[model samples]
Target: MNIDIKADDSPVTRADREVEAHLREMIAATYPDHGIIGEEHGSTGADREYVWILDPIDGTKAFITGRPLFGTLIGLLRDGRPILGVIDHPALNERWIGGLDYPTRFCGAPARTRVCATVENAILAATAPEMFVGKPAFEGLRQRVKLPVWGGDCFNYGLVASGHLDLAVEAGMAIYDYLPLVPVITAAGGVITDWRGQALGLDSGDEVLAAGDPALHQAAVAILKG
Candidate 1:
């Protein structure tokens, strides 16, 4: 039940530290040559050919508030490209996983994104408007969408991959925050990229846009850029 604040003013709890440490141990033991990067523990061998990105708790605020909207995010980068991701909502007993060569799966079944090929028809969600501070153009993108709900954290991306949500956009994210979402959204027949419409990678900036349909993503990116 312990909680502490990180320098970025984000909350971190005992669960976050414990989970990340355990996962890091397992990964190090099983894949000694692969790199590891974690929100809590930092990185090691990050220049290796393969790296694992970890966010032990993607929605710590939601978790501390006793909401089930939190999740553990795990992503794999092969040569700096996101090739796989897993989002696990332990409290809800739901999970989503995907990879470049595999279709997305939710709760052991194949999952896919819903089709809404344009932004005007899409439902959008972000963690919060405050997260977009100084990025006024995000408001324009919000207005273009059919609906914009806030505060789902990483769960929103999993929903997009599962066909329950259409678009998820956010800024000020770290590699662990958005990397895990890349493969899940893309393998579900959706698209995920930065505001520039380029692929997400270790070097990508914080702005992220994910859509259940590729065309819809294109429209959203254009609005975000304007």
Candidate 2:
């Protein structure tokens, strides 16, 4: 399987399509009643109560470049709220999975957030600095924030959910890019939402922020809302 990157710089690869195909086939065979919405392919079986949202390769550019920042995102939504999420970074040999009954873990051990307050002391990540689109609010927020250690696609959110980063923010991401992350971060004792602090769900439009602690999240939101 081979995938072609679009003119917009969004990437595609064999792994991306293959992973989604495999997952779709498995879901169809095991849970024939459920629905699926994927990045590469579109939607199927919409009438069911359960929907599997997939971004087979969250960072296809990184994957193609061998950067190890790419990942396979799988989210199971029940009644429009994600109940199970799996982020697999095969190149990094790391996979984070969480659900109603499953514990949040890095590898096999439980993971928890560290108390990091004040933007100055916090580590941050974002997909692109230009994505803010000349919004002074976001510019002001960036200035006030602490050191931005690294940036990537959904990998940043994965780091925040795993307690390795304090926050991850992005200006214009689709539901597929944000929905799978909501449950993963929240289940790990973190907070996730749009710039206004509104709860992130399947239907949330674009913008997003994921933080490991509530106070950090509130502070970040205040900056973004400014």
Which candidate has the top score in TM-score? 1
Tens digit per residue, CA lDDT, model 2, 44-103 = 975569999989888777877778888888888898888888877888898787777676
- Each prediction's TM-score versus the true structure: 0.98, 0.92
Please give the range of 10 consecutive residues that has the lowest summed lDDT in model 1: 217-226
Q: Which ranges in model 2 have alpha carbons more than 4 Å from their true place?
A: 1-3, 7-9
Please estimate how well model 2 matches the true structure, expressed as its whole-model Cα lDDT.
0.81
Q: Report the lDDT tens digits of candidate 1 across residue range 1-226.
A: 8899999999999999999999999999999999999999999999999999999999999999999999999999999999999999999999999999989999999999998988778889999888889998899988888888999999899889988899999999999999989999989999999998998888889999999988888888888878
Model 1 quality (TM-score): 0.98
Minimal lDDT window, size 10, model 2 = 1-10
Whole-model lDDT values for every prediction = 0.92, 0.81
lDDT of 1 at 173: 95
Alpha carbon lDDT at 125, candidate 2: 84
